[model samples]
Target: MFSFSDQNGFCGRRCVWVNGPVIVGAGPSGLAVSACLKEQGIPFVVIERSDCIASLWQKRTYDRLKLHLPKKFCQLPKLEFPEEYPEYPSKKQFIAYLENYAQKFDIKPQFNECVQSAKYDDACHLWRVITVSTNGSTQSETEYICQMLVVASGENAEGVVPEIDGLKDFTGEVIHAKDYKSGEKYAGKKVLVVGCGNSGMELSLDLSNHNAKPSMVVRSSVHVLPREIMGKSTFDLATMLMKWLPLWLVDNILLILTWFILGDTQKYGIKRPSLGPLTLKNHHGKTPVLDIGTLERIRSGDIDVVGGIKRFNHTSVELVNGETLDIDSVVLATGYSSNVPYWLQETEFFAKNGFPKTPFPNGWKGKCGLYASGFTRRGLAGASADAIKISQDIAKVWKKELNHKKQKVPSHRRCISTF
Candidate 1:
């Protein structure tokens, strides 16, 4: 019901003063925070660039994609997936859940209004959220001022397709995983999927299942763990252990378990680094792929595993090990960049690589009414927890300010009567 009407104008401009926080992006993080704000009776506004909620999951993701982690670990605060749903739901089911969540909280985000820039005003002690909208031949700009600003755009804001030598020289089609839908068109064709991350592994498996001769380009060392261990979801067990055990102990125990479960990956041409999975994750913020089928595909000889790409030829790719294979298409699953620096260029909110220098799980909230959400290394659950914590913190500040104002009201009235 929020609008940019004449009555809502402020500072002689097309502005609306939001009493609560202004959250950018209507994804999981933003919705979680919105739910908390509603519970606290705080008026807030969420501006989203996409046309619908959870567009990242609803639009960009492929049809074959599913939740890598169990639904129990991925649920937001006070919102759990139905018991009828699977432990790991498909992309469509997950999107439906998010839509239901937004509806349940009556959270309506302003869609199709992309945030162009944001700045904190020192004199006013507020944030200015600038947005632009285009309708046919007309374009208009709008500004929003709020005391608290939450940037919940999430980490995968931009797709990253790594540049390689002679990429243009290839005659076949080239696309990023962001554009990949289904593997139907790739059936019977040799496709090279670059990167061994979750997307890469999953996409390669999808292609293989669709009758495509898929090969995964394992660029560097990666930890690939089985999705299930001894009849239980590895994620479920990990969560249970993480709550009680220290990180180091849990990490080492999982490493030993993986070794016993999957044996030596190097023997099958899968080389892992010397460090453990959790160590690599903590140091580099890399999520290890929980394999549901990719490992089995590799063992069954349905999918081939190759080294990193050296370069692309006419219809072939040369690997770092000097191996060349004729490929019909190439899918870059290299992953995504945070793209924070592009929007927050003036602020020290992010590093040069578009990732937060002091990322979440420690220092997501900074001074000057600036806050970050959904940038945690622990994925969805961590992002949800961060949103709830941030909303509570903002509520505490508002409470203190209201109490101070209440204390001043009685004194101000007595002084006026004396005058």
Candidate 2:
């Protein structure tokens, strides 16, 4: 129950009862859904915390970044990358595509409105999304009451920074991979890059190209696959093989191919997981790092692949292997996590990690008209799939209500999916 007399509580805030769903992100996933909904002739309000769409790409990513996968796998719905664009579009090209997509769909997100809390109001049977916006000294709060809610804020809303022993003791600069743009500033410095995911590998490669000596930390085992095999995308090849073979067989084929192409990566301190690449990805969401010139650099000794760090000294890191290396700076390519748990005030749909409790293929829909998009670890392709499903589900219910009710306005909770 909410208090009607309270000054700063539910009743006091400016409330807008939305005619349709409220999408909580403006990234590719959100834009995809927006386009799908547009096709369905259903209106939605996209609420974005950042001033611009795809803020992660525009603000956080490195300058040398390119789509690790082929452009065909990374595009949004209703539009494809330009024909002249390369197979793996650059960071700028991808961003341009997203911007064009949003414009084509007329997806105008409410920029800078940070969602503080979103909860299902039992009394009214609607989702109450409370948001706060600030401009100069003035701050305003708005409560958006909608029939359906779409959580498209994505999995990488916040960067992860691990706490290292004696990290503060280091006198040199420390930065997360999100802040890293280029290696131009580290031309001659010895930099230690933590984590061996795509960002870590790319950062190390970039640093090496700029004449910086970089030691990349491989704390644990990770599967690394060549971006392409025999002029075909490694991922595309895997997908095709999976159609005709069992997962284990597909994994073996991939391993055999990778061996022939890149050799045994364990020799360079990078170990493969016990499960196959696709198997690991399906079960545990562990994505294999798709090599993009980083492996050659590693082979050439331009980038040093190292073991985990034991601790940080004033100007060096003590490795778990008992080796010590002096470094001028530290770049933590520690990855990112979802920010849903911070705002969404519900328990059943979203897990504590801010992902749907149900795994992908079934994670999109939840009780009380909650839906998730782009939470799938499968990247843009998964997001596009989710967007289509969500739009179809919502549109079906909405149209049914309109047809049945005739004169009555399609009431709240009408878009609830039977699934």
Candidate 3:
């Protein structure tokens, strides 16, 4: 069912025709969908901009990074983590699991193919995906034509680097959290860590552990919850409670427990948001920080917590509170956003921010056989659910159409690639 594209002429442009779908990512979301479609006896070709699978995990993540949530909730569909893996698998462990998943499912993505544009042809009734790839000094382009197109590039495809006043003037090491690997290089130096999300918190902790002084910026209010409650995971507890109790009640209970365990985080320059953690996340997509030893480090005076930045000097940072501190490096953990809007031509299904106009549980499907897999802010569990739904829905339609087409079903789909 999978073969090289026909050598026929299309003005010398390479083209690939897919009978099933062209999945536009090789990350967990796309992998999950591909695995499910394979189970349904569907054919698909994954296209990844990066060469390796899960490039974020393999290349961008820090050395000490581990899953913020437990492994059970993070696993993809049709496969479970190995029993030997810890509750929170490290970055390497997670990457290993993804590799094994890809191997098991036989999901071979066309790596290094970055989609330039994807648009639907109204008259032809097919999705056209134009991709550009570079190999050494040589570059190539490919166009894929398919009935169904699965947009699985995900939310964190690109990093967000904010415009900071005097950032260009600062004469010190500046890096985004994506390129940061370890604090080994910053040992015995003062480092300014921007953003207070999970990455910022964990990165600051790692800096302190490596003997580097880290001052994290907490500009706005954030909900910092204990990673565990007594012996149970806070995430697990909340999920369990939400099944039977209301979300508000569950939020309140978790907050109370967090206060009891972590004490008044506000006293340490950290402010909790007005809305409850779950409510804020649901409404505004602001995820509460799950404290993983960062609070303890802060309390112990190991990791300093600072306020917003007014500007940066040659060797000092001016804070909104009129305070200033000298630092040797800066790590902007400003987070990431989706690149869907940049390449996706349609506007109705996806908003200007690149997320679906419809939210999770309903955002997976769209008109003209278009689908999205990981726009869900709910993480792996939500994505896994979407993957199953997308596969099943596509299967139903594909089967019906095939039955109607009868003997006209083509055995080979075209693909365009030239060495």
Clash pairs of candidate 3? 5-415, 15-416, 16-414, 16-415, 17-414
lDDT of 1 at 373: 82
- Which ten contiguous residues of candidate 2 have the minimum total lDDT? 1-10
lDDT of each: 0.84, 0.91, 0.92
In candidate 2 the C-alpha lDDT for residue 243 amounts to 85
TM-score of each: 0.92, 0.94, 0.95
The digit string of per-residue lDDT tens for model 3 on 1-419 reads 23344487544457778888999999999999999999888998899999999887888889999998999999999999999999999888999999999999999999999999999999999999988886678677788989999999988999999999999999999999999999999899999999999999999999999999999999999999999998899999998999999989998999999989999999999999989999999888889999889999999999999999999999999999999999999999999999999999999999999999997669999999999998889888888988999999999998999777755645443122121
Query: What TM-score would you give candidate 1 relative to the actual structure?
Result: 0.92
Root-mean-square deviation per candidate: 3.7, 4.8, 4.5
Task: State the lDDT at 146 in candidate 2.
Answer: 91
Tell me how candidate 2 scores on lDDT. 0.91
Q: Give the candidates in order of TM-score, highest first.
A: 3, 2, 1
Clashing pairs in 2: none
Model 2 ranges off by over 4 Å: 1-12, 407-419
- Which candidate ranks first by lDDT, i.e. highest? 3
Per-residue C-alpha lDDT of model 1 across residues 311-364, encoded as one tens digit per residue: 889999998899889999999998988766766634576667755668557656
TM-score of 2: 0.94
Deviation in angstroms for 228 in model 2?
A: 0.7
Q: Choose 2 or 3, whichever is better by TM-score.
A: 3
